[model samples]
Target: MEEEVNNELPLPDIEVNSDVPRGPFALLNRYGNKLKRLSSKGGENSSKSQLLSAMTIMNMAEKVLSQSIHEKRGDVSNLVEAFGSDYADYLKRVVWLLDASEKLTKRQYDEAEELLVLALSGSLEGHPIETVLTFYGKYLQEKIEVERGRIDLERKVEHVDIEQAVMDLKVGVVECEQKLPYSQISNFTGVQTILDSVAAAERIHFIDFGPKFGSYWILVMDALARQGVKQLKISAVFSATDSVEETGNLLTSFAESMNLPFVFKILHLDTWEFKKDHLQLEAGETVAVFMKFCLMPLSDQPNGIGALLRGIKDLNPLILIVIDVEADINALDFAHRFKEALLLTCALFDSLEACLGRGNHYRKIVEKVHFQEVICNGILSEDGGFKRCFKIDLWRKYFAEFGLVEMELSQPSMHQARLMVKGSPSWSCCTLKMNGKSMIIGWNGIPIQFVSAWKFHYPVSPAIDLFILH
Candidate 1:
């Protein structure tokens, strides 16, 4: 039996002849053309094409089955008999995924959950699409669980195993810092700013708020060692829930190895709870503040960030370094937040896919711990969970309102950022650009993270100026 399908001609080459009858074959060709057009744009449009294409195939199959039934064909088998059973099964799964994607885009959680469940029932291993689908499925499931009050029990369990969770988070953050360019850029720029701001100081006191694995301080310690600093004190501030002893020990070991006089102190307080008294500033020591990937969560509390900034200003640090993700998920409606979070996370996942193999352990860890937390908190949390990221512009305005002035990052840091991006073949799509005084690292033209330096606009009194001048 000869099939009416024309596989030889490409979709664009298939002409819609006016003389041809308006049969299923002609309609299929027209729909195929539309699919091609939609798929060319990529991203969400590609998902749309999948939806349209799957629906069109199902519609054609229905028409064929209807015809077969009307003609009294004995034991009419598959409607897509020409493509065989495997193709039919594949089409069904694709349809479910497409339907789920549409539902997620429309914020229809219940329908999306059902469709994703169906799609995931079959084997989808070793495919990028499988990863994407799995992420969405987990997100939807979490949302459903949250609505049913089932996640609260899980949160309690997490708190009970807080040590293990913190360990996992530390591992994930280390993996991210090692694999991705954002942390490297921020750390390098921040270290350079610190060095420049305190060139003449013999003793430096560095205060780190929400320290991540003590990686930034490692860089600072290395730089200060090279600069022949006589003494160094690092105060690592952590939230009450955070396990700080491990990080304190690591920094202490590293500092001893460098033969630098280092004092490590752990302060257990939220960022908003920090005060000048907590720092215990001493005479003849230059103080600098570092906040990396931590400030955004303060938005969850009313005026939390403002309070922190005011406290930091009172400390009169020579320089304040901030490294934060570039996003506008805070203060947005659920629908808008979902859209923005989806776009941001898709780019992040795409970048990860480009850089790491599908089965890489670090990639799995990063996706599970880092990206999943951001996606869920950004979109699913009712009270703007920990990942309430805002853009650099908004952060700039906030700093200015708190009496902090933006400072330009040094040229070497800029050159290092560009060289880092250019040196890696996998990071070819990553880009670096300066937004005013801040340095932005983007993937595929979408800003992912930013690093900026700031200082109090008003200098301290002469009576308190015991440290060496900049």
Candidate 2:
């Protein structure tokens, strides 16, 4: 018989292994800040080194419990103190044992192990090693417990510092929820509320200003199709910051798949920049500009509202859908300004509100991905703050100034829930009574005017008509 030739390729060497492997729970540069509080001249040592040392010692002790260090467990007799008598002495002992483990002779390893166990068991009172070693001890116990139920087969349970582990888990769950396949759920449910309100309008065009990935727009288009929206031409202008080709392609594919009559195109400029462009005025295209979570980045940019109104007029769309985060305690704070600014527009004006809530839900959600730095640090005016709530008022005002009025929606989008996603549509609106009388209430708890849609009519007459009418 011929010998079989082995064909499987060897796996690459994995350097990160047990004894406190670097992972989500591993020490980070944040620990350096804690260490800085302990030393007067902490500048001498880089924070990275201190963090590395702390993580390594904790990791080693977590894996091999019986190992020892040359230095006595939790003994700080010869070391220089830091912080106070209690905190300084304890930290020294922890650092000394960690240092001893670095050389890692048999006795030193054993001693280090003893110190960690003693610290976790609370036998070594008054030592701050408890705080540092706690993660390792918990991980060690979890590993032991996990292995007991699965003796026949090897099983490994991932563990990190409790806080980091919790954060990671929350992020994973949220991402999974947002990433559900479209086929799994009918798309109509998502945009049904918006469609119903705008159904009476003469011409309707969906305009997504910042169409990141275009998933939301696709869903909205699908929902419109379900509502018997056959001859709709959508002229979307996406900010260039996100992947343009990806968004354009996805929108095209979604439009094609649904066999919808829509001309979808992504813009190559920022939403703020789009406002500056001299767009050619078109007749009867009910331009509903959907800018969900995008406006926050340009909150401080001068003439942001004016730019939006100008863009709407240039398009001469019958309706302009203005959606964004209602980030304020007072709904009037947002609505009053938004309505005022939008009224300046010569085109039609109609507004609606949805998903209105208290604290800035949109900003809080974006902060998770380090995008907060952009809003807080980048968009902030030289004065370090601006009337964030002003955008809401401007939109509301613009609606009133234009001929179109608010068309109340029976079912509006949930404000806080949408804030969970890091995309546009993450906004809130104050609920108000939509009688012909436009009353701005300082208002108590009961939701009154919760209008988020701005639906208006642009006359099919030439641009001269607009100028003459104004």
Candidate 3:
């Protein structure tokens, strides 16, 4: 499959299809009309459902146009003509990504490279979203190189080091409030459900696998703070030594501020050494295990993921909540990973335009750089622990293997999640789904991330949410 990718295939010769799309004109119009309606309509603002409709239409249009962008060819007019310069710039980048992703799947390396170059040409240097695309471009181009026999498939990022990832979790600090994951977590009903469940229990032993900055704890603490918990004890797994003290301090301060009875521990361990016993748990206590944005690192370790699951089974936590980006980044096949990476990142990048003003310099940087690093790591690099992520289905399989069954998230949880989404900016478009025992969050219809809650024994009916442990 990698061989199909032409490391240096030029853009398909511009050939105007007798049936060109007015080329992205439909989506352009849909976005503009919706924007105008939402901004112009006073008091009686457009509904979220309507906003979602616009976003879904725009996304679908892009996907359709992606497949036939080559057909639009030279006759393509200025995007600035239809939409203003701002929207035009966004469309250009979207087209470039769609073009590149579509071409990459078709193994047109040179053509994809041209689009990538075009996207990279301008002041994309400082943008996080652009940085993400850069990583995607790098990974895809590297795949072409490896297939061309220029480099080995096992190349790793030379200096893969941990940064202050948890710094953003600081309450009231709006530095990275526009982050997509925050929305996913806050809007994730499973989180609220788990917290509410534990709040009633006598004791809570919460184990986090890879606690990045203990932000999950902060979020959890925030929720607990709101409702007031009886007693809660948390065990955080801090991978970076530098973050250990800070995470502890912040969590301690947060618990005190919230006035919740909280005691916690931070376990610092590296990937190769993750052990089943490492996840400390009391034999008799209501326990919950959390792995939010942390599992991907250990995924590449041989037999490591299996051992981690086995350890989880031994603990027998009443509830296991796993939340991560919804993509099959672990797939070895280049084309499959590329498509997943492209679609997922596009959805995320598109979603952020809500809180941040369109063409907001800060947002562009966050999307280009920070999130880019994440997407690139997941989809591109074959080694150096850059293996990206997997969706909820795979996680369900793992949990099932450990004799755990999927528990339907409570309707209350779903309602909470729904409220959170409704509470966000009216201009933002996020869709939530609850089918059987699964909870998913998506940008438009494309599932960007998902959350799954599981347990040893699930009641046959979804109505049986509350029960005694014994």
Candidate 4:
């Protein structure tokens, strides 16, 4: 049976030319070669190979349609028919997405809406490109609605129940954490860094900038209990709309169950309003700040990220931990942002498919609630919302500008990440690498998320006193 299957889908042996023009034929040929190479190692059923094949077909359909349009040809039927019946449904959907994208670029709202509707009507449920097509189709629909003034983007977005959305998002995140290693890598590395930083301190003051789920702090609290720390205070800062009281209550209960002397403080304010005094800091306590998946929402605000970072600097915590998705989706141009979002989503969906069964309920929830929101807000939101993820290099520059220097993640953190990846057969393809002082968790060679630690760059005069005190 295996031999027959391999024979039916034999790998191609095409010679790819580096100087070939990026026309329809050349693009298709290159992607075909890519598919062949990917499948030769992992077999035809590998998630990466399947995704690459789908992308190749979509690109071929898009290129042909685009070329026909630019040449003033009226009919795409003949061009699409050349791919034959095997890909007819998939090609039709891809062509519709391409057409909708062109219409969106041209500001033809009605045409774009019609094409998006048509593209979304059919079922591509188990297909590799299903999530990508659905996200792009819905994004285009949102764009058309906004463009036609049929809906107010800000008003529509504001009407969503923030608390309920946060709760749903927390559930989705926990689901993903169970099935994949990215979140585990981030949380484990973060907890390890915090413990190493405050190893000698009798009292610990952990300030979390965005404690939407507060799951990471549970790990911190458990670890502190095991280490025999005397007192632990967790000050959770939340945007006014987040479910602050619930998260605090949950953490307080967990801390009590562990018999850890815990103090929970809540600070509800905008990120720009963060200040040292707001934390109600006490003397003789080691301080650490955790910003997990929080800063990206402020990327669209005018100097909002800088202001927040400056505020954190003023607090001068012993260590600051940041864990965020790695992507370059902050471009100003709509088309550029769209392309970046598509690539990111494709990689994400491919990773999910690799790790979870097709009908897994949690996987479906994560894709629908968490990633769908990410795609929509990242592309369609005027304010960038929760999806303005930027690469770690850009984040490093941001920290440097605000007087924070990168602290190399300890060896144990790297080991913890490796153990998590190796523990699960589903996570076999997950890659962990150290980039400079940061640790990156990648999927099939594409960096998906990163974990980095930072500290205030103290001057020589005060460095001695600070070093001695901690």
lDDT of residue 335 for candidate 2: 21
Q: lDDT of all the models against the reference? A: 0.61, 0.35, 0.54, 0.66
Encode model 2's per-residue lDDT on 1-470: one tens digit a residue: 11122211121232322122222212211222322232222112212122222222323332232232344533343332322344343344444433333323223444445544544553333112332334333332332333344322224433123223224444432332232211111122223334544565544666666433335455566655655664565555654433545555777778788877766555666665665243432465445554444454455554564455555656544443444433332122322222222221100000011111112233123222322222222111123243343334544544454444554322222211121111212111112222222212111112112224455564322122111211
Q: Tell me which residue pairs clash in candidate 1.
A: none
Lowest lDDT block of 10, candidate 2: 344-353
Q: Report lDDT (Cα) of residue 357, candidate 4.
A: 53
Across residues 129-172, which tens digit of lDDT does each residue of candidate 1 receive? 45555665566566656665677734632212223444756665
lDDT of 3 by residue, 1-470 (tens): 00121111111232322221222111111222333343332122223322222233235436445455566633223532343443444446556755666676677878877877765556543333554456666766665666556776666433233354334333322343423434434334455557655666666677776545444466666665655556677876666665666666778898998887888776677544555577555555788877666566666554566556656666767787766667666555554565566666656655564434444445545554346555556555654355547677666655555567887664445544444444445433566765346766766556666776777663222211010110
- RMSD of model 2 against the true structure: 25.2
lDDT of 4 by residue, 308-412 (tens): 777787776899999888887776556567766766676677667776656655666667654665577556765434347688887776566557889976555
TM-score ranking of the models:
4, 1, 3, 2
lDDT comparison, 3 vs 4, better candidate: 4
Model 4 bad stretches (over 4 Å): 1-88, 108-118, 150-163, 168-173, 240-247, 382-387, 458-470
TM-score of each model, paired residue for residue: 0.70, 0.40, 0.67, 0.76
Q: What does candidate 1 score on TM?
A: 0.70
Flag regions of model 1 displaced more than 4 Å: 1-125, 142-176, 211-213, 240-243, 383-387, 458-470
Clashing pairs in 4: none
Give the C-alpha miss distance for residue 129 in model 3, angstroms. 8.8
Ranking the candidates on lDDT from highest down gives 4, 1, 3, 2
